[model samples]
Target: MAAVETVRGLVELTRPVNVIAASVLTFIGSFVAGGVTAYPLQTGAAVAATGLAVGAGNAINDYFDREIDRINQPERAIPRGAVSPRGALVFSVVLFAMAVGFAVTLPVVAIAIAGINLLALVAYTEYFKGLPGLGNALVAYLVGSTFLFGAAAVGEVGPAVVLAVLAAIATLTREIVKDVEDLEGDLEEGLNTLPIAVGERRALVIATGLLAVGVAASPIPYLLGYFGAAYLVVVVPADAIMLYGVARSFDDPTAGQVQLKYGMFLAALAFIIGRGALEFGGV
Candidate 1:
């Protein structure tokens, strides 16, 4: 039981849920680029590689944010003394190596992308994370690249670019909202995050504007005929939810943040369903 608890703590240090989500996005990218049957091995490798990279990034983030998290999230592994900072760093390096190993098995494009993303993840945590807007953009780019990485794994990158753009916008909005939610702790830590640099209200406005842009662009895929009517059916509601979340942020940043998270997940689901429906005739 003690050993199991230790293992669980280590896993939690990596933010397993977020890693799983990244893996799912990678698979969705693969599905969007070409059906699963077309690139099963490449898709599987991409999912594994992306998940590991995300997990490593989270672990390193926790290591760097140990002090901030001690105040904002004491229950986290490092803050709770379940994992030491050095141990977490070492674990993260190992995970990054494994991710790169998996990526090297795929096409050269996947290898190149994996290398660049890994560096970006480190740079974000070490330097950019304290800068206003730049940090948010870097994180958003990483999220968006998961789809591109998937497409690259199979040597198909055309349509995935559109999806990547949508993902980046949605992620940027959510990251800003999260900064707003963590403003108090971040300010105390001397982190110049968006909310800290510009007051929370102003940050909320920026986030809302970004969300609006994403909502407006949500229909582009369908209009471009990349996706069918089923995409519109699900994506329309997803966009509406995001818009409502943006409105709610004016009054309640935390609640709006939660809503945006759910909205992004729903939007990704809509993409999968829409694409599947078009390709498999209602999968």
Candidate 2:
């Protein structure tokens, strides 16, 4: 019973779903770039590395933010006493080392990207996270790189990269909404999130504009003859759902739960559509 509880606590602390999401996007991006010639083994290993990096990053963030989280999110594992800060930090280190090992199984590029991912997570947790727009952009860049990492692995950059970038924009847009959701907690901690710094109304407007751009940009590849029509057909509704989520958030900014889920859906749709189109189009 003690071991099972400990395992569950660690699993919750690591945020496995978020890690898996990164891995899935990375794998899909690699598949799209490589087309039919994609190496499943290489892609799987890269995804595993990405997942480990993401999990480790989360743990590190929890360790560093334990104090802040005590006030802002007392239910978090460390703050709730389910895990100690030192234990979390050690767990992060182990996961990061495992991620590096996994990265070495692939090309040098994967290793480099894995390092970048870890660094970005650290920077975000330590400093960037308090800097309003900058933090949001950093998160988006890291998310977008998963796709670019896939492309680099296969020695190609194509429509998949564009789609991934658009997906990142959508993610950034939703992150702003998340900031609004946490405005009270952030303000208590002196964290300068966009909603707090720019005012919630202005932040909402910016989020709306960004999401619009993301939706419009997502289908560009198909429009430009870079991908099959099916790509647009699949992504359009997903983008529409994202837009709806953003719009709804305007009514209740604390409803980030909706936006976050919608963002995840958008990413999943992008991956699925990108992969299906690339595979069936014979590109």
The best candidate by lDDT is: 1
Evaluate model 2: give its lDDT.
Answer: 0.77
What RMSD does each model have against the real structure? 1.4, 2.1
Residue pair clashes in candidate 2: none
TM-scores, all models, native as reference: 0.97, 0.91
Segments in model 1 whose C-alpha atoms lie over 4 Å from true places? none
Q: Which stretches of candidate 2 lie over 4 Å from their true place?
A: 35-37, 281-283
Compared with the true structure, all predictions reach lDDT values of 0.88, 0.77
lDDT of 2 by residue, 136-232 (tens): 9988888888886766666565646686787688778878988888887788888888999889989989999988887777767666655666666
lDDT of 1 by residue, 151-242 (tens): 89998987788899999999999899888888888888999998888888898889888888888888888877677789988988888888
Error of 1 at 136 (Å): 0.5
